[model samples]
Target: MDFARTATWATAIKNLNPDNDLSVPLSDFLRRGQHFAEFCAFSLRESSLCDFLGEACKCAAAACNAPMAKVLQLGKSANRLTVIAQWGMGHDVVGSDAGLAEEGNPPGQALVEGTPVVVPDLSEWPDARVPELLRRFDVTTSINLPLIGRSGPFGILEVDYPQAYQVGPVEISFLAAVASVAAEGIELMSQREALTVQRDLKEVLLREQQHRIRNNFQSIANLLSINAVKTKDDAARRGFQSVERRVFALASMYDHLLGLHEQRDEVDLSRYLGSLCDDLQQFYALKEQGISLHCNRRLGMTVDLNTCTTVGTVVNELVANAIEHAFPDGVGRIEVALTSNREGSVEICVGDNGRGTRVEQCNGTGLQTARQLVTHVGGTLTLQSDPGKGALWTISLPSKGHSAA
Candidate 1:
């Protein structure tokens, strides 16, 4: 049988046993399903908007049988619809009208003074501005759709082809449908924005909050830095540096949160993890010493910004503990892995062959604080060691989705 057939058979085997056996395959397969569901449900909302726009563009392109087509979202506050996504286009034309809006600019003629204008031929346009733009970008024939939405004129969908192509009636209808979808998406966006706000408030009660969390993290780091400097001992200074790194990790999560709009609930965890790892490696030199990342490229899920940041900080702390305590002589290996189970729990493991968790050596306050923070987020940390083998720090992030209820 093929791979799909094989998978189907394997799934049948699992379904046959609802007893929840201790087999690794049974557990892993179930976990993978949960993660997959989360992935589909929690992906980019803007892409849904972007997809609608792109489909409209594709339809319009096919109707005209045009070689090149593009769609731009006219900024509500700005005068132009910026190029959001595109398909088959001219050489000089790439990024030429990227953000070109109507403000009495050269290409501004295409926007029809912020109004939608359609031209059969660019070189033979009645408007001087249209012909001038054609000359600037070289010979071109294009149709511009003033993407009208529920609010007002949103943007322009420009479909272009060489001199011979013609924009037909079928294309025009499809173009109109594309415009309608874009409008509908923008209208629902305001509604979704309200829903997102309510969702965030439910996650953490704070009014008038628009990413002030980032500032809070920075402030904490500042305080730690000052305290570290006040102590003269090398060990005391090292202690503060440790706290500072954890604080920065939280700051990075806030950065991800601030990047999202009303619709986006998740950020690229691989990108997020790689960046945090880079910062840690630079300071502690994990790259120079043998460190590898085994994180899933598609490993991402949605949680409240506060929760993610908290997780990030904990990861930073545990990773630091492994690096500092794992390889005492500054030589060893470390691996970071992020995987989620089907039951909605996330398994984040950071391991090093240098040494076991030196918790007994860690001071009481730091360890206690770390433990409390993990508990708050519904997670637990496990420190594993083998006599001569390295150390393993396994962190389990509880599925906030089911539990948040």
Candidate 2:
């Protein structure tokens, strides 16, 4: 069977009416059509080819009122058909193979001729192609329908009865419809398996690439650290260390990437920010200067890698600036807090209880860089300060990567 034949059968099934002059009852046509619809509706619930085939065999059997049914597929060599699914049959009968050359094998004949074969009375028929196992079970009547796929006939659907049942055109048409569904299911299952394999391979390659990039970033940071230690000038040493920390901040993005199997471009904003703050505290020796740094706890929120990197860089520069310029006596407190609202907007505040200076009074490039970084990612940065009070730098980010007013 091919798509054309399948479409013709579907048309016949759809045009079914009680007034038509048909040998079979109208109820049989309606019932069989219902079975086809039900099978199609629930097919997605099947997780594997074997499971789908099993349900298909059961549906075929129930649709035809047969006691036993089985499905056979042409082997890779195309010389034999192997039993892949069965209903109301012993487990031992599954996985059995039937040669295409067998004189009376109905399934083999169906596959070879690309048509259905009906043995209404196997006992009276000459050289009937019934399997030996069916003979042991006293199967007297059987019908084999070719399961057609996109390429052509690929398998057979066989239904057997214990009594010498009279097979009719209605039964044959219904079984053919069932066979079409089974063929389509088998093809879909094969495609799904192939896609899963491809996705697994891609994931492996991505992980390897991320790992190599992370290592390279670490190497660059290490070289910068070494140079920072060997430098005699305090300003040059500080510059080297600052560049090294920025490199490390970028590298940390890949650390999150390596652990993710899906959503590779998104990072856990809460966790990443917390980790960055801890690293900054240790690197700047905040505890030794009695300048305690604290980051408030936040619920997990995810942001894209680009946005995350930009926010991290801004935070790094602002924190470093606060440590260097805000606390003149090296004795003050700094707090970092992240908050999100129902509108999906995010706000980050880095505040310090130290002698404050207005934004225009600052001379370093750190504050300028931080403001530019925030604006580049469609966010806003503002500062609140008084001469003897503290400085509070607040960053506002809109949802969906939009700019805040």
Number of the top-ranking candidate, with TM-score as the measure: 2
What is residue 155's positional error in candidate 1, in angstroms?
24
lDDT of 2 by residue, 1-405 (tens): 446347424532443333456666788767777877887776767567777777778888888888888888787665678888888886777888654624467777766655677787778765555566567768888887777666655677789999988776667767767776777777777777989999999989987888788889989999999999999999999999888877876766456534453265666777777887888787778899889999984657777778877778888777877888887888999899988777978888889998998878865676677778888888999989998899998888878852222
lDDT for each residue of candidate 1 in 1-405, tens digit (9 for 90 to 100): 223223222321321222344333555445434533333333335556555555555555654556666676656666654566566653344344444465433234434553334565655654433433345445466666555444445566677766746544434444544444444554566567879899987656443353577678878889988989899999989889877876776666556555343225544444566666666676566667765434432344555555566666777777777766666676766677766778878666777776564546555565567777778878887777765677777777777622321
Give each model's whole-structure lDDT. Answer: 0.58, 0.75
For residue 25, what is the lDDT in candidate 1? 52
Steric clashes per prediction: 7, 1
TM-score of each: 0.42, 0.81
- The 10 consecutive residues of candidate 2 with the worst lDDT sum are 8-17
Candidate 1 runs further than 4 Å off: 1-232, 259-263, 267-271, 288-298, 358-363, 400-405
